[model samples]
Target: MPVKVRGGLYNPYDGHIDPYSVTQALAAGARHYGAVLRPHTEVTGLRLREDGRWTVTLGHGAQLTARRLVNAAGGN
Candidate 1:
């Protein structure tokens, strides 16, 4: 089991996650729950709609309506 890690030493951790495996697992789980995963898609613009929905613009003039958005881009 992995424990909560708080910074103390130069490098202190009890566990690590395989990025590739975790990503694949998350994608699979999302798909299993009927969520569409669009790879290679870039967000170009964002707009708030009057109906409380979000208008997300993607690369190459694609757009989508999302009820929620999460900023999961870590250090990128």
Candidate 2:
């Protein structure tokens, strides 16, 4: 058997950065923008408020309010 391809291999720019460094930088930037990062918190429910904001219900009956929510769950 034989395999055929129209285009050959294309290698883009190669780079590497420490994962911890990236995470730290993102945390710092978020803090600079007045964003709060809550680790170890589990989201139990989510609902839209009357003012179009989001009411996030966390574990232990804790709640959070945000005008916008970003679900960065999966990798790019």
Candidate 3:
């Protein structure tokens, strides 16, 4: 998310359309393609362990472990 791209529709031509729904649809497709979609969940913390794995702590008191953390969190 850039400073200028606050709303969902970051394109100037398609500025009239809502970007939120587009993002949701993409998330659904990604989930169908083996992606995990965690909506409305805030990442309270991310820590890289000595074993080279990452730990993600959610605001809801949930913890998840993964190999890496790719913070493509803006659109999804």
Ranking by lDDT: 2, 3, 1
Q: Give the alpha carbon lDDT tens digit for every residue of 1-76 in model 2.
A: 2355433334366456567787799889988998887776788899999999999998899899998876644343
Please count the clashing residue pairs in each candidate, in the order shown. 0, 0, 0
Q: For model 3, how does the per-residue alpha-carbon lDDT over 46-73 read when each residue is reduced to its tens digit?
A: 9899999989999988999987555667
Instruction: Put the candidates in TM-score order, highest first.
Output: 2, 1, 3
- Per-model CA lDDT versus the true structure: 0.74, 0.77, 0.77
Give the runs in model 1 whose Cα sits over 4 Å from its true position. 1-16, 71-76
What C-alpha RMSD separates each model from the true structure?
6.8, 7.7, 4.7
Candidate 1, residues 3-59, lDDT tens digits: the string is: 554322232574566767877997899789777766667889999999999998988
TM-score of each: 0.60, 0.69, 0.53
Q: What's the lDDT of the predicted structure labeled candidate 3?
A: 0.77
Give residue 32's lDDT in candidate 2 (0 to 100): 100
Where is the poorest 10-residue window by lDDT in model 1? Answer: 2-11
Error of 1 at 59 (Å): 1.9
What would you estimate as the lDDT of candidate 2? 0.77
